[model samples]
Target: MPQVKGSKQYHMVVVPHRPVRRALIIVLLLVAAGAAVAASYYWGYHQGMTQQADAVAERDRLREEVSVLTRESEELRQQVANLRLGSEVDQQASDEMRKEVIKLEEQIAALEEDITFYRGLMAPGDNNTGLTIGALNVIGTDIPREYEYKLVVQQLATDHQVLSGYLNFNVVGRRGEQTETIPLHELSSQVDNEDIRLRFRYFQNIEGRLTLPEGFEPERIELMAQSTGSDRKTVEKKFGWLVQEL
Candidate 1:
């Protein structure tokens, strides 16, 4: 080496290519690890979104079920209320109908009595208009084999004298081909005497209780009224009789 009087020298450092290769490999590994982490984060976010959507759908279904139940409950309540109101209305209607029926029954009874009274006031003087049996009704009594009967005997003439006669009641029934007759007085307690005295001017209502034998079905009733005093006029009347127990 030869040294000069005014020369300057510089020192330089040399880097190896192996260190660069190692740094590049380290950078690539970091980039790959970061990419993998990003991919995992994205997949987790999508999974969370899917799970949230499923939860929302399930909540909507539950709400729908609750709405249906509420509607059904309200409908049942309305039906129950309607049934209660309907029962009350029906009872009121039935009560009104029953009252109207009772009133009509009373009116009918009053009209019948008035008709009987008017017939007595009006009478004819001619002899052609004689005694007549106006109405006959037989009702079953409370006791067995006993019945009550009412007979309305009317006369159109009272100018001659008061009608004085005797009444005979006979129960007639069919025994095979012939008709059989049994006296009512024989089978009766209230109607003890066979001959009942009858005295009236215009009309006479003869009411008495009658009795029949056990298992006796009378087909008809024969009523005979005979004037016992001066004129001796005889009148006969018949009525249908069906035996019934109370």
Candidate 2:
């Protein structure tokens, strides 16, 4: 082998694919970051939607509960109103009853008063007996010449009837002259003479006519009556006679 120029060893410059690798790596990292961001955004949106739904459901539930409570409150209020109305009606009825009771009591009291008055009226032994003398007339000088007298006798006892007895009347003149004793039965011929019996609590009227004496003038008259009872009760009366000229 002839000695040729020394063969030089060729060292080729080898450039590595660093840029492509770096670019690929950067692209991958960017994709991964983008995916991660997208995933995070989606998760956040879903969480928001879920929270919204939950809030809506909670609001709906709250609204339902409020409606139920409102209905129950209305029912309770209605019940209270009804009870109050019932109470008022009962009070009104009680007031009416009280008024009626008062009216009835008044009526009963009035009736009782009327009954008492009637009872008093129906009581016995009411003394309603008296006597009366008619006007006396004179002939000329207004002096009494003739006189008419009426005597009324009433039985005081309402239990039994009384038989008529003799009625004695004495007329004392101004001159102290006395009249005669007259029988009551002989004075009235119209009456039944069979012992004039008067019913219980009845009045009997007896009339008599008398002529005065010519010399004496009558001024006053006195009357006395005696009942034919077992005790013989007597009644006396005095009256002034009016003397008028006829």
Candidate 3:
């Protein structure tokens, strides 16, 4: 060591070797990027949950609409069935009414016929008091060309005496463009005798069954009655051939 006279004093200070401020800035940027990514993920999850809820609601609404339509269709079917049944019942009722009306008409016609017959028996419209023809009727039978005939004779006198007579009848018709007349005895299957005798006080009904020949179209009937005993008289009558089928 060397000795110096009158020397000045010196101070010592330390400086940092690493860059700490730049490292702090880099760490702050990394934290900001991570926050942005977390925010985006949360938003997407919320949107997906809301869309699922909306789809579920739409499905329920569609199911309700389908159920309503099904109920309406069932009601319409029931109404149609009821209408058809009512129509059938109405048709049956109408048919029955028509049948009843027809039956009533037939009964009325029969009653009218009976009234006419009784009136004729009570009053005869002829001047001859000895013997007279009241009515004549022809009825058709089931057998072909066969018919039943009825002749009614009445007495117009008030004495009510017994009358005896014999009747002769003939059927006048056309056969193949030729005039033909058939006697009652020849045409009648039930009456074999030529003389039809009658004995009655007020009225007498002579009935017989007859059959016509083939191709014989009858037009009229002629009858002649002759009284026997004290009241000797002769009566002639003509009647048109009209057959009532039974």
Residue-wise C-alpha lDDT for candidate 1, range 1-246, written one tens digit per residue = 787868896689997669888999999999999999999999999998886776566446544655565555455455545655765788755665556555645554554454444433243445545566667788888887678887887665523246788888888986566668988778667676888778876568888787776656689899988776766677898898854445
Q: Estimate each model's TM-score.
A: 0.51, 0.33, 0.53
Sorted on lDDT, best first, the list reads 3, 1, 2
Candidate 1 local Cα displacement, residue 21, angstroms: 99
Candidate 2: give the clashing pairs: none
Clashing pairs in 3: none
How does candidate 3 score on lDDT?
A: 0.75
Ranking by TM-score: 3, 1, 2
What are the lDDT scores of the predictions, listed in order? 0.69, 0.51, 0.75
For every candidate in turn, the CA RMSD to the true structure comes to 44.9, 55.0, 47.9
**lDDT at position 178, candidate 1:** 66
lDDT-better candidate, 1 vs 3: 3
Candidate 1 wrongly placed segments (more than 4 Å)? 1-95, 98-102, 109-113, 124-128, 158-160, 174-178, 229-232, 242-246
Residues 31-70 of candidate 2 have per-residue lDDT tens digits of: 9999999999999999888867765664465446555655
Output the number of the TM-score-best candidate. 3
